[model samples]
Target chain A: MEKRFLAIGWVLSVLLLMGSLSGCGNIEPWVKPYERDRLADPIMALDGDPVSTSYLQHVYEAREGARGGEGAAGGGCGCN
Target chain B: MAAKARPVAAAAATSGRGLTMMLRYGLGLLALLMAFSTARASVLPEDRADVLYHLYTGGGVDIDGPSILVRKQVGKSVSVVGNYYVDMVSSASIDVITTASPYTEERTQWSLGMDYLRGNTTLRVGYTSSEESDYDADTYNFSVSQDMFGGLTTLTLSYALGDDLVRKADDPTFQRDLDKQNYGIGLTQILTKNLIATLNFETGTDEGYLNNPYRSVRYFNPSDTSGRGYSFEGELYPNTRTSNAVGVRARYFLPYRAAIEGEYRFFTDTWDIDSHTASITYIHPWRDYTFTGKFRYHDQTGAHFYSDLFPSAQATNFRGRDKELSELTSYTFRLKASYAFLNESQSWGFLKKGSVTASVDWLFVDYHEFSDLTANALIGEEPLYSLDAAVFQLFFSFWY
Candidate 1:
């Protein structure tokens, strides 16, 4: 079982590596820098408060059976 | 290595030692490592500080603590961050009440991290340690993030390793070790002038003693003298489990200067636990105050070996009664308000802005199989267990 898990991890890691290797160069920003004012607004900030967010995520993890894959966080127990 | 089940009451007390802090949140700052890293090919994180008070009450348990975080840039290319957190728990929980005396315990954690940026790439390294009377854990992690496609997209790859030692309070020589590993990939994209999105995928594995020695599975014992028809035995769990999760989120700016976001995630593990979670949030700024509301929903299947009551002892190779492993559905509703007291116009020295925010979350859960033993009902006629919890967060943050 352990060997099988390691194999799954390695295979996915390789696929992710391949996907990341296919980037760089120009993909023109459809929305110019100047047009991103709304996107840059504080309200639109994806993760504005790191401490608060991390604490809440930890609480959810402790109580739920699920963990990880939610925003660099864990089990998506959805107690967000 | 697989462990032999052993009976003990101390495990119920150690239940609050904290199982989640070992992971160290690789997701919280991935965006800050990328989208926020734009413009300057080598931009370190911003300097900031936060002090917070958090409280959770429910399930006959009370956990309240203080968390302090500080981040400062050491130079043009490097930034450092540190955190000190504590959890003071008073638990008279269902498990504790059933088999042992109520207990009070404290868990403290410390974390330090550094980020180095060169060109359009950022490298991060971190360490975290958590300690309690019967449990101790340490984790180390590293990650690299790149700004691709003219800063329109960001990709972050990360890995973490954890080592944990669990000890039985009543048995001086009884101890166990658990090892864990996590792998993650995150992508952030600027979808449009008014929209942004992130997709994160994480996989992990755990090995060694995975069950609580202080926790037990209940089984019918016809000859038991106790009026209750059931008896308890130590829980037995598989020695290894692998899990996978994928989550995606999107935030969009409303035409009226408000923001709305939606998130969805799917999770599955070798233990046969599958879960789906979704949430929606709305943020609105009025004058100096930002008001936000969120609703979240989650549903999951029980682990393969989870059973509230077994027909007899050793009914299965692995038996567990932990409610968290039971099929359940949960909902959370939150309301938050943040007031900005300082901004560019009212800056204080090196502090460019400051805000104090408070939020309250109401949580409710309905268990499909786990029964509430506190009711003291007859066998097989017990009421389904449910939980209600309230979480409160109050904090002040300053950014330079």
Candidate 2:
């Protein structure tokens, strides 16, 4: 199981690294120095800002050992 | 004396020049440190605000209730958050004593959080208090994070302290005083623009009374002549436990406005129990709305010496109890989906630039037992597989 997890991690890391590097290739093309205050838009801060409705729903569920935020906080209940 | 005076005169001249240079260098170093500290706290834009509220309702093997949270950024570097939650649950768990009452517990929780960002670092502090019918608790948490490797990597360290006071009706003298502490360190690396990976490790420790005063193990008389029929008063006191967990999660962007994330966690505790959790999620984005779906699986082994019954005439100094705490195991499966709506421009009279989200979750759990003590012990009448729960939640957030 450990080996399997490792293999999966390695593959995902490589894939993501490649994607991020390649994505930088287009930075100049779509680069709008300013785009209507992305922070004002919820989608841009989807990962960090916890004040969103979905974030709360997921946090509560994850703390309860239930499914939550896009597969985040997947773990056992310490109290259980 | 003349030669010495000549060298001293020359040295004095050099000393004057060197003193100024050293003074300037010192001032520059001080300025850099100040800049570094400030850099940790990045300023938030003045025109942005966010608020959110959530409500949850559900029942099954697990019960869900309602919760609310609201946050606002009032300054360039400061945001305040408040949260409250209430839950009423009836749990028929597959724990050590399969036969205990379906715990109908009531819980209330409240918390406040503050965050400051400057330069390339963020600092956060929060305090939380909770009451669950017979139990009361208070917790404090602080964390600091710094962006590394030019924003590709982030490192964070967090610490938390908790105090619990549990009052039980069974033992008038029973005061379950507990102290819990946790320390976590994590790193998040943006491997690629579309892929983010994070690794985190946490250590938690609990000290003081760790047993349930109302729960007891019933000992049965063995057929042998060894007077084993008498039940023993079992109680545990002042037990300390520590737990450590490591987890890794990654996000992979897919084609056509979609992304997939996968996560794995491994956990173990001083009670000799080990567990693992795995989960996957997929996100789909549309013009003004977004949807997400996720599935999770978790498995755990029970602690050592956990049982529902024991031999009454054991030769050792045994707590002749029907329930042994360390011998039960369980597994759970959960599925959830959520949808969110983003506001493009000001909607309400005030700045209403927030998002609304709603989600549903389902969970199933199965319990297991270890020994005959557990087999014969009166457990919950419900089948092990009868535990299931469905949760629904709606949340709305806006900023000024």
TM-score of chain B of each: 0.90, 0.74
Residue-level lDDT of model 2, residues B3-107, one tens digit each, is 000000000011123233333333333233233332122333234433333333322234455556666676667777777766555554443233345456666
Question: In model 1, which runs have C-alpha deviations exceeding 4 angstroms?
Answer: A1-24, A72-80, B1-42
Best-performing candidate as measured by lDDT: 1
lDDT tens digits, residues A1-80, model 2?
85586557656655665555544322331212142232223232325334343334443333322121131221110001
Off-target runs (Cα >4 Å) in candidate 2 are A1-80, B1-62, B90-105, B170-172, B222-238, B313-342, B370-386
lDDT of each: 0.78, 0.49
lDDT (tens digit, per residue) of candidate 1 on A1-80: 85586557656655564455434232355666677677768898788888888787887776677878776421111110
User: Model 1 — TM-score against the truth?
Assistant: 0.87
Chain A TM-score (model 1): 0.57
